[model samples]
Target: MKADVQLLITADGSHTAVNQVLNKTYHSIHGAYQESQRVYIELGLFSAFDAFPDGPIHVFEMGFGTGLNALLTAREAERQQRQIFYTTIDAYPMPPEATSQLNYDQFFGTSYLTALHESRWNEPVEVNPYFRLTKIESELQALQIDERFQLIYYDAFAPTAQPELWETEIFQQLADLLLPGGLLTTYCSRSYVQRNMRAAGFTVTKHSGPLHKRDILKAEKVR
Candidate 1:
C-alpha cells in the first residue's frame, strides 16, 4: 500500500507528514521532533538502556511512518557509543517523494534521514557502527518473528483510526514479543487501551506527554 502524505511544519519548527488516507499526522502536530524525542527517545530508549545496561539494545517499532524515530535513535546510538538494533514495520510505506520533502535532514544537519528511507526493506543495514536497522514492509498482524525486543515504539495511528491494533489480542501478541521488563511506549493513554494492555499482562503507567498531549503510556512486561 502507498501512503499519500503532505509535509507540514510542526510547532517545534520540525517537519511531519499528514496521511491523507487516515487523516492522521505521522507525528504530533504540536511538535513532531519534540514528541519523538520525549516519548520515544528519552522515555522509551533511554529507559530501556538503563534497565539493560550491557549489550546492544533491540527495539521494535509498530509503525515506521516517517522514519524519524529510527533516525533519532541511530543518532543517539552513535553519540552515546551504544549499540542498537532497530526493527520497524509499516503497512503503508510512505512514498519517497513525500519523504524527500521532509526537513529532518536540514533540522538535524545530517543526511542520515535520507539513508534510512533508502535502506532496503526486510534486511538489516548498518547505518553506523553503533546502529543497525531493519525495515519490514508488512502489517503488524501478519508479521511473524522470533526476535524479542527490550523496547517497543507503539507509534501506530490512533485507536479511532485503527482500533484493531489496540485490541486485547494485538496487545497480547506484542507482550509476547517483549522480553521480561521490556517497555512499550505510546502517545496514547486512553482508558480502554490501558485496559487491553492490562488484560494482556502489562503494568501500565501514565506519564507526562509532549506538547499538546496530556498523558502518554509506558507499559512494562514485568514477568
Candidate 2:
C-alpha cells in the first residue's frame, strides 16, 4: 500500500518517508540517522542502561516509522551484551518493500534491518540473543499493554501534524505504563508538549537536540 511513498534523503544521506498527506518527514531533515542516535539512543536507551545496568531492559516506541531506531537499538543491545525487549506500535505501517528502500542499514553498517520488518506484529520475536522486538499494530491512543517499560521512544509525528497523540491525557496514559525512573525521549522540544509530560507526572528536562534543532525533551517518570 505504501509502495509509492516518496523517499527523501536527509542531510546525512539516510532516507525517510515523506507522508504527503501530513506534509511531514518520518525523521528530521537535518539527519535521520543523527537524530535517532542523539535523541532516542544516546539520551533514551543508553541512559536507561546506565540507570539499570542489569538484565532485561524494556522499551516501548510510540512510532515504528522507518524502524531506524529499533534497528539501531538492536545493534547496541548486541554490542553491549544487554538483554533488551523492545515493543513498538504503529497504526499505519509502511509496506515492507518501502522499509527496505531506506538507506539506514547502509548508513549504520548493520544488516538486521530486514529482520525487524519481518518480525510479526503483536507478538514478541527474538531478533537476536540480546534483543527481542514486539511490533504492535495499533495507534498510540488505542494501545493497551500490561507490561511496563524502562525507556520510551516517543517518535510520533509532530503535534502540528498529529495533535491528538500529543494531548495531555495521552501523555498521562503513557506515563501510567512507565516504571519509576523510566525515561521518555522525543525529538520535540515544544513547551506545550513538555507541559503535557509534566501534567502526566513526568519530570521533563531539556536535552541537547539533534542537528538543526535547539533542544529536545527527556521526561522521567519520577514517582
Candidate 3:
C-alpha cells in the first residue's frame, strides 16, 4: 500500500512528512530542524569530532527520510572545515514533490539542499569541499556496509511504529558497524531500546531531548 504522504508545518515553522498509513511523521512534530540539529548534529557529529579529531569522519545514517539530516550535516561540515563522508540508507525514498515542500532553504539560505536531493543515489557525490554523500536505496535488512563508521544517525521511525527495526538482532548488527569508541544518536529513549543497545555492546547514555521530548539516547562503543 502506498503511504499517504503529506506535508505538515511543524511547530518551529519547518515542514515534515506524515505517512498517514503508518500514522507517523517523518520528523518530530514539535520541530523538524530543531530535532535534527540537537539529536544528530550537535550530539552525533560534533561529539564524534571531539572524540576523533584530526581525521576524516564517516557517518552512517538510518532512514534518510526527507534528507534533512544530510543537508544539515553537509552545511556543518563546510562551516567547520571538517572532512565528512556521509552514508545514509532508505528503503522508501521520498518523492521530489514531497521533498520540495520541506522549506529548509528558508532556514539555511543555501541551495546545497537542492544539490543534496539531486545527487545520484548508490554513489558518492561531493556536495562541497568538506562533505560527501552516498545515498543507498535499500532497507536496513538488506544493507551490507563494509566500513566501520565513527558515527551513526539512528533516525529510523519510532519503535512503536516499526518494532522490528528496534529489536536486539538489528541493534547487534548496528553495533558491529561501529568503530571502537564510535557513537550512535537517536531521538528514542525507550528502556527496551536502551537495554537492547547495551546487549549489543554499547555504553548507552541518555541526554535531554529537544522540544516535546524528555530525553534522547546516545550509545557509544567502548571496545
Candidate 4:
C-alpha cells in the first residue's frame, strides 16, 4: 500500500487529516492523538492499570493510529515495573516510516524507540522487558482476537469519518473480548455510540474532555 498521507498544519499548530488529493477537508488528525491520551491513559487504562494489585497488565486498543498511545503506555510499564500486553487494531495502518516521523520518541523518551518501531506485524512482539504488543492490521469490525483484556483504548477515527467501524455489532464483539469490569474509553461522545455501547452490555459514563474537546466517554463491561 502507498504511504498514508497527513494533512497540513493549521495556524493553531494542530494538523488535520486530508485525503491523498491534498483537500482541506478530513477528520481531526491531531485531536485524535490528544483525545487518546485524555480518555485512554488519563481516564481509563492508567487508572485500571493502577487498580490491578498484581504486576503484568493486559490492554486492548481499538485503533493503532501512530502507535502514540501504545508507546506512552509501554514506557510507563517499562519504568514502573509492571508488564503490559497491549493489542491494537487498525483498518488502514500507517507504515513504520510514517510512525517514526511523529516526535513521540522525543517526548516519551528514547528508551523504547528501537523496540517500538521494530515490532512486527502478524505476531506478538515484545518491545521491552515490560511491554508486549500484538498488532492486528484489519478493520475494527473484523477483529478476530481471542484474548481477554482488562482495559481497552478505543481510538478509532471519528464516527463521521468511519461510521461502520463504530457500530453496535462491532462494540458488542469488542465487549465480548473483555473480562468482567474491564474499562473501555473513547473520544466519541455521540449519543448513538453510547446507546450502542449500552446495548453491547457496558455501563457507560460521560466525562469531561481535554483542552479542546467538550466531553469524552467510558464504558465498563460487567458480566
Question: Local distance difference test, per candidate?
Answer: 0.93, 0.88, 0.89, 0.72
Candidate 3 backbone overlaps, count? 0
Candidates in order, TM-scores: namely 0.98, 0.96, 0.96, 0.86
**Predictions ranked by TM-score, top down?**
1, 3, 2, 4
lDDT, candidate 1, residue 13?
93
Question: Every model's Cα RMSD, please?
Answer: 0.8, 1.3, 1.3, 3.0
Better of 2 and 3 by lDDT: 3
- TM-score comparison, 1 vs 3, better candidate: 1
TM-score of 2: 0.96
Cα miss at 123, model 1 (Å)? 0.9
Task: Give the TM-score comparing model 1 with the true structure, all chains together.
Answer: 0.98
Q: List residue ranges in candidate 3 displaced over 4 A.
A: 1-4
Instruction: For residues 78-124, write the lDDT of model 1, one tens digit per residue.
Output: 99999999999999999999888878889997668867888899999
Residue 163 of model 4 has an lDDT of 84
Q: Compare the candidates by TM-score and give the number of the best one.
A: 1
Tens-digit lDDT track of model 2 for 63-160: 89889999999999999999999999988888876877888778878888888987778888888899999998877878888999999999998999
Candidate 3, 34-136: lDDT as tens digits: 9999999998999999999978999999988888899899899989999999999888877777777778888778677777777788989999899999999
How much is the lDDT of residue 68 in candidate 3?
89
